[model samples]
Target chain A: MQFERAVSVEHVQKNYGKFRAVDDLTFEVHGGEIFAMLGPNGSGKTTTIRMILDILKPDTGQIRVLGGPLTEATKMRIGYLPEERGLYRNVPVLDVMIYLGRLKGLSGDEARQRSLALLQQLELDEFSRKKVSELSKGMQQKVQFAVTVLHQPDLIIIDEPFSGLDPVNTLVIKRLLTDLRSRGCAIIMSTHQMQQVEEMADRLLMISNGQQKLYGSVQDIREQFALHAIIVEGQGDWGKLPGVVSVEPAANGNGHGADRALLRLDDQTAPGDVLAAIAASGDMHVRRFEEAVPGLNDIFIQVAEGAH
Target chain B: MKHLWIVARREYLTNLRRPSFLFAAFGVPLFMVGLMFLVTTLISNAEGDLDSLGNIGYVDRAGVIAAADAPFVPYADEAGAQQALQDGTIGAYFVLPADYVDSGEVTITSREGAPDSLKEAIDHLLLANLTPQAGDDALASRLEDPVTLTVRALDRGRDLEEDAAIGVIMLPVVFAVVFFISAQTTSSYLMSSVVEEKTNRMIEILITSVTPLELLFGKIVGLGVLGLTQLSIWLIAGALLLQSGQGVPALSGIELPLDLIVISLVYFLLAYLLFAAVMAGIGAVSNSEQESRQLAGVFTFVSVFPFFFFTTFLLNPNSPISVALTLFPLTAPLTSIIRLSLGALPVWQFVASLLLLGLTAALVIWMSARVFRWSLLLYGKRPTPRELWRVIRGTPMTAVGTAAQE
Candidate 1:
């Protein structure tokens, strides 16, 4: 059985005077799924997120988080890490975290306990007493992320979570997200990091120019971009297959006796048919034949470029 | 309520931790105290020369006026007095002509004209020595039946000595100085903090954690409490200095009513809130320090204008201008406290003034809350008063959500 919908947006539209920020947006974040909203800059990803948070009301359509109108109580169940990270600069890391936790209705002692635990998990326990400005940019961002999830909200929303982190910190946060997902938190992240989306996102929503261009499971989106390509380790004359559209030598090039070829299929042909046909060429030694699914980056570029 | 306290505690802690806040709280007061000490010492040590000092000689025609009882120096005759004065033996010579008691006129002979002080002393002496039989009705009334209005305050908690009066007079000035400093410094703190956060895009994290109202209230409460702490230290220092009698008179005899203290505290609280709210409103709309200062200028004026009315309030605390000033929330905290510290205020008037001030404070706070909610989201551009009013009327609901998260 499917888990309940943690967040649902039904044809929501937001307009700032004459400028439409989000237009006819509709999506759902299912429980325990890592749903990523993928978009280029100014594609209304933040705007849609704001609408979901009830920070900005939709001009049209409806939004429900956990099956009801958004209130302060509902907000307590949702953890948000905005694209622009901030804390009171003069306030210490621990104090700001506990203070944020308190807003979600955690008592001081409870907030302190949870915040310290989070800081430890983020490997920032040593600098908890330092002011936000005293910390390095990446360190402050980690502290901000810690504050966001200290209350362990059922739905976690992070915008541009890896915008400024070094590779190590990015891996740390990606691991944290994975851990959170395992514990049954519904994570909705918005980012231009297609690599992250490809690796972490289970479902994806692609928006272009304030309008929804694509929304589905990551596999489904890749399937929708049916420009099929396959990598084959066969030796000779693979480009001679009847339905093969194009052939490119793999990065190892043809110099190595053990080489691979990327075969593209025509619109009407299937990668399986091409693989079968290539296998019939006994002149080629076949070691591997695997169809390459479209990556999130490829899907994003294709959909966004398709829209414009 | 718990959330409010959490917010308030956060505000207080953050504010207390700020280097600028710490500096203003301790540095400004200590500087003022040092400056005042230096001023008092300078004035007390001011020197005078022979030219600046006054001297006089008396010629007593009436044998009744013995030489021992002479007001100034005694000379045998008018020529001798004139010769002595011209020869620099005296500053001025007084001629007590015949029937000087009845005439109440005394001639003075000198090379140079007597100064105002000597003239005043000569008149005083002539008046003091005059007989009662020769007294006019005004003189007899002034001497025989002086109207003595003894002050008896209803609530006698602390004595109001002359030094207390001095402190009382100084109270308005002190609070005015503090209000001035606080309004300038605190509002800038509020403004700069807001602007810096907005510019740096740090407000986004804050918005997720706290409501705009909570943030505004927290900041005001924190800064106001801090301001009061500084003020209390200054007041205690002042009280101690007066009591020590290093040169200033000690507080003695006059009592401070419980009602006055209560009213003063309440007024200060309300006034601080009013100012704080206005500053928050300014901070919300401000994208820069220069813009914040310009926006908060009106509040600064309201906070400091009471000092200009200090003279009038002292002369007649119950006068129409004083009454109006004391009833105004911005001025009431300082002016009303000054009035209460001095004698002769009716309880009802004090209560009425406080009530008015409280009501005004409430009104300003409510209005400021509306403005703050609307403006806090707007960044890179300041909202106009008209736009703020529109937000209050709910015309621009969309704008409310666009607040600067920082």
Candidate 2:
């Protein structure tokens, strides 16, 4: 179901009276990619998502969803999981799913079959006849995610996909999203949960107060904001090493490596040179050694606060 | 169009099973039929009045009676007649005034009420007093107490069937009641359905799948069909009642113009379109059920505003207020149906009312679609009238300060 281009928003601006909700924003999501939209609470990420889904119209720009404007026919090819997600609480789970799937242009049998399969995959088949309100929050979140992808939409936009999920369920959803992406789906996911974005998103965009603060591939953006430092875990006297200006505990989590440390280099030092020096030091045996790059969480915090 | 149909089907099916819809659909016809049976049974029983008024007492203020008889007991004064009435000497009394011969006016009072026997005795007494040959005149008059009522239509050159005339007059009232109840029930269902979707945040999910226009029309058409289902049941019940009610004399006779039922149905559609559109807009703009009701109340007030002046329309049919309500889309359905039922409304008023009602309903639906689209995603405090107006005017009101589900 790959289209020419999944979505292209050009110079989009949306305002509610004097307050600009989005301003001159431009971006595109192509097939077979996960684009993370990172922002704090009320940071226009949801607004931007709605704009792309054609739920909200941009004031002064053109948004071509699924190659052209988001028409009734094209709307079927897109899916959305809003932050304030909901299903018909009183309706049976499978019925609700089928209704939504049918609304998205799926045939009844196709929707029912797909819904049952998704429910089974998510281990929710037993609750298919139960009311949605009867499900636990985590279970409901899984159901919501299932509903989003039930129609196999070409362009999927999800907000806070893993907000209230346990690690196991989160992994399940993450894998599902990844699988969708592998099948040439263009997914735009918005969240403040930076770890998931770093793990799953190929490229990311950060918006605050309706303006784009950052937009690039996950690795390139991380490296762009990377510090001139290396992290060394295991037994090491890293503070006394040559070209080492300082030594401190790693604020960013470095996993279960023994005795972790983040080594800051001087202005004239190279990260490769520092790593070579660490290896030459006979006094140290390192478990993990890598150049330091700031996580998306820190960058998100910095950008959101800076915008304020 | 397919999406619209899907949405409509979902709405229709989902609400069809609602308790309120079921009750309105089935309960109303049963209730109306039961009421008709009860009322007609009582009216038929009432026609069997008591045969005698027992020992008639008269004040005889005119002193016209020469002497008292067994049935006729003359009292000297008004006090005597009252005393006699209280003492159980008489079951009822009548006062023939002092100028009885000249004016020929007689008044009667009875605790047993004026039964036919007492009334006929008085007629005899009057004929005997006024005529010298009292016995023959009284006997001749008593054989037949003559009066008759007959309705004839000169245009058709035939006497009206008593049942059909009654039916013609009663059709509008029946229609008005059913329509008023059904419209309020179904339109509110549409409103609350919209509000529920908004409250549960399901609008966001639906808006993505279908256009707002599709969403609005789907719901209106779906619930309109629901209303029609209810009306169909009532119509069947009504036909059953009309067929059976002809045998019950108190139900009288009915002659309904086929055009009346057809016109009522036409007005029902127009009324529903206007009402459902307004209600859908209210639901979209409101954040809660109470808010939806509060906003919906404005239309309720407008629709019923004509009722206060209903008599004016019935009397004049061309009064300003009457014409205004007949043309006003919200008030037109019941107003026109009722007035048209009474007699022929002028052709111009009928045509203009239909045209205006239809045009206004169409216009309101257009505005409601705009309002529905703009307001479905909005949350927090309800939007003000001015804000709603701006949205209706095609201004994009992005929900900025409010949480746009962020």
Candidate 3:
């Protein structure tokens, strides 16, 4: 299925004195997709988000949200959850949510009703009338999320969305994001959680030192960085195999015999060739054999190290 | 504009519902009422005690005056009067020497200061008794008050009514207090609100929905309205109290001129805007409430600097320092209001000062918006003076948009 663009950023650059915060950054987020912005601290992810939200204008770039420059009208269709998590600490949670919703163009009644439903859905109904300061950090995070999505924004940008959530609440938010995505809301989230991104993000852009290190679909990027190797479960002297250059024990400790090994292939060796050799040797019984795909966490470490 | 109103409404409601606002709005006036009641009661009780004192004894050695139907009892000699005073039969005693009329002096002995009413009674008794046999009641009255002067203003070609003179004397203080209260309350609110938003990093979320200008003006207008509401409540309550004859006695007969009232309100708004914008700018650059308040203190001091020169301005509205302060934007709102209250400010000066003040307020507001937008995302470190100048001059920070060359 074809997808329309929700946000397009081109050649965006932001500078703070001699320090360049973002450099020639270009990317696009499409409708009904989850786009993760992967970066370390001070990698200009927040600055890029601010530019997209039009909170800070890029010195030399164009950002089109909802097919046009950000304006007062366009802001209504966008929801933003900043990395800094805070609400009016002295105000009731429901009131803060409703106020934020109204700022996003919802009518008072609509804001209140939607906020009420969101609070209930998030299991925060009991604390709706409590001051924000009275809520726990995780609860406040949920409240912030509710406010972010209260007006049903067409595009949602959340920075560090699950920072303070526990395992259960994290799963809850993961489901919520997938639910929003299925409803055709475009989401651009920035987080340090590679596992979450690996599970959820359709595409991601990784930047380091204000420069793009990688960009593409998560699967494509992972495949491009995959090591040419296979994991085998059969017990054998895998390192002594003809095509095997090196053998490392698998960390999962799932070897059929005393050892499960990851056999690294030589330059010209194919994984199928290795499987045939393992079968022909018949010195070991094969329980499992599959190509090893690099996890996002490993890829992130590799790319970040390479950039430096 | 709609966003402005939305933000402003939130600010208004949020602050208006606070316990602090409610306490300030009602608690102060009630406290003042109770204080006034206590003071009046004490004063009246003291007066009653003084009036109940025993008759004073006097020794009239001059023999030219005799004690009549007064609070005094005559004694033949000083020794007898002293004895009566020591015996507590007389509350106090006065001795008149044989040459008292020529010396124009009398000695008094008392454990405490003589009451003013008792002294007046003695003066009346002496005047009545010393007059010649042909003297009439009219002559006795003339002796009490030898001369009386009535003042008339040549400019208006009429005598100044007692109440008008009193109004003239009281107007400056009234204007000063009103302006001080309104500006102090609203500007502090503006500063603290901005600091609060910035500290919590909510400014980032807010600016996404509204322009910094909208946010700033929203706070100013919202808090301005709140301050006006507070002032109105006080004014209405005071007026009611005055009409019921339960207000401060000194303010009972004072007339508040319509023009003065109108001018005072205009100055209140202008002064609030000027100071609020300055405070907002300070808040934008500050990282915490403590820092913001410290900076705000400077502006507050400058705004109230005119009050320190109150006597100078009231004594001579055209003094160079007074005129300079009245024209200087920071002090103009208060100084102009005070000059107008003195009932002597020239029309041209009034218009010029107001125009200068209004223009300055606009400029400050615009500058505040720019500063706020530029610095809203800045955290951890305060901007340097050069960066602040750049913001004020509309210079985009060179560090903000440069692409990282890899």
Candidate 4:
């Protein structure tokens, strides 16, 4: 059972005075999936992640990682990236990274070697001797991220990992995260970047105001917020289609030219029937005939707003 | 413990590598040697010259007093003395007014900002002159030829090296101050380190593979080694200084008791551990360096109070105030060690104080460890002294982390 779930946060709660930062959040991160906790700022995502790391105690409920109680032994199996990124500012980047890696039981030489290898791979080898304070924020963030993974724990939790990154750096981190996931590590990340969630998250948990608003696969969430959108481009009017709920003009250029209207379906009509109805309008050519799947972003907005 | 070693090793290396500790360790001794050289040069110049004493004047109405014995030149009248004093022609004046014969009065008149040493010397000379005139001729004759008895201790053990031991013990006390300061200053570095980790939210990642207690213990133990390392070097330098320097007269008849050295080591370790544990607790509860400083006020007060009352202890080590302070757990380690070094201690009091101090240290460790366990995870705020007790009684320990001991 422990092997089945890499991290299980069961009805965990944390309160600071009267404010419940994490209120009865119950979720399980599977052993090999990249699960994401999606939320806006101050929504308790980091609080929940910290509880799993055992840096904080829940006022109530239990948390188990790698199938057992949180102990020194269990801690070896997890890596974490905190929301506020920092390292020892006065120390050299390599020294700080290796020192932090040493805290996780790596030998000094081994940590040093690994730190060099990681820095080189991240194209940060030249700056290893530079003080952390001298590095750019984006570069420092990368170094901190490397420190987090230096010991190579089986489960990695990253809070706002792509925050404050340029698009290129963000892409680099996205690929690195993908690579880690492919290695069969159970990676759970909390981020505000919805695009990263669409690209990487296999499953997700969305919470707001310390309550779970959505929890499931991307496909399931999108289906839950399903909307019918069709692209039509013929002389026949889009309004003439039977059971059509609404028709809105969409982008007409960029290869799919001229007449394009996105058609929304009413409740009782199948997308096939709408396709058949569009077929019945012989004067019009239906360039695209498919149900518009709501993305994680759309689902995020719909479900998050619904919760409020 | 291994984790603690790793942390300690890092702390020691980091501090040792820093230019500040290096300056304190090697540079300070060089600075001290330079200062001593300057002192010796001043002494040599003062001994070689008479004019350096500056023009000094005195008026003595007592006709029996001779000019040769006086510290200043004797003037015939107050007018010449007053003029020299005010014009800065003479450094200062010692006046023996006529009324002084009946009342034994002496007054020093100096220009504003006259050298303080000259004024002090005049007062001492005037007092010595009045002593002989305190009685009639018969009593006065006895004062000149009074019987003097030579004093000696019952056991003249280690008499030759007694003066050196004064410097030796002073080394430890000075080392203790430096130790108390450095240990405390660096230990707050640990507290600040922890507070920074907490505030930056980096602690969330750290505790995943190491317990907060382990981290706390590691920091204290690491910084403690750095302190001890610095102390050992300072001790060696102090011993060297005593061996080479001119003798100190006050320390000529003193000897350190053998038990003092043995008791010092034992008490220093116990006291350090107790204080370290308490500091870790404070560090755990504090969320900022500013908050940590405020929390550390108690430790600072305890460490400094010993230095303030040191003279009183030196005067009478067995006085009620000394005995009471030496038995108090917070002060006993430093005070008791000083007392033991000064002379042979009464065995019963020493043993009783040790027992009381040892128990208090143990109790302090347990209490501090409890506070550390409960409060390390409570971030974004600093706990009050009262809140810490409530945390110790029955606070939750569950949510801190799933630490995997690698």
Retained true contacts (fraction), each candidate: 0.45, 0.72, 0.62, 0.55
lDDT of each: 0.71, 0.80, 0.81, 0.70
Name the regions of candidate 3 deviating beyond 4 angstroms.
Answer: A1-3, A15-20, A239-245, A252-258, A266-283, B50-59, B70-114, B127-171, B244-249, B399-406
Worst 10 residues of 1 chain A by lDDT: A249-258
User: Chain B alone: TM-score in each candidate?
Assistant: 0.67, 0.75, 0.82, 0.66
The residue-by-residue lDDT of candidate 4 on A244-306, one tens digit each, is 888887664346656766788787877788778767777777665656776677677776777
Clashes of each: 10, 5, 12, 16
Tell me the tens digit of each residue's lDDT in model 1 across A222-295.
87775578778857787788878788876543364357777887878887787677667667778877776666
Quote the positional error of residue B250 for candidate 1 in Å.
7.1
Tens-place lDDT per residue, model 1, B95-194, is 7767876776677665655556567555545544454444243574466445644444554333344434555566545645654465456545655666
Q: Which has the higher lDDT value, candidate number 1 or candidate number 3?
A: 3
lDDT tens readout by residue for model 2, A1-120 = 786579898999987667777888999888999999887777677778777777766779999988798887888888889887787888889999999999988899999999999999
Clash pairs (backbone) in predicted model 1: B158-B255, B158-B256, B159-B254, B159-B255, B160-B254, B160-B255, B203-B405, B203-B406, B377-B403, B377-B404
TM-score winner among the candidates?
3
Worst 10 residues of 2 chain A by lDDT: A250-259
Q: Which pairs clash inside model 2?
A: B163-B253, B163-B254, B164-B254, B164-B255, B167-B254
TM-score of 2: 0.81
Candidate 2 lDDT for residue B143: 51
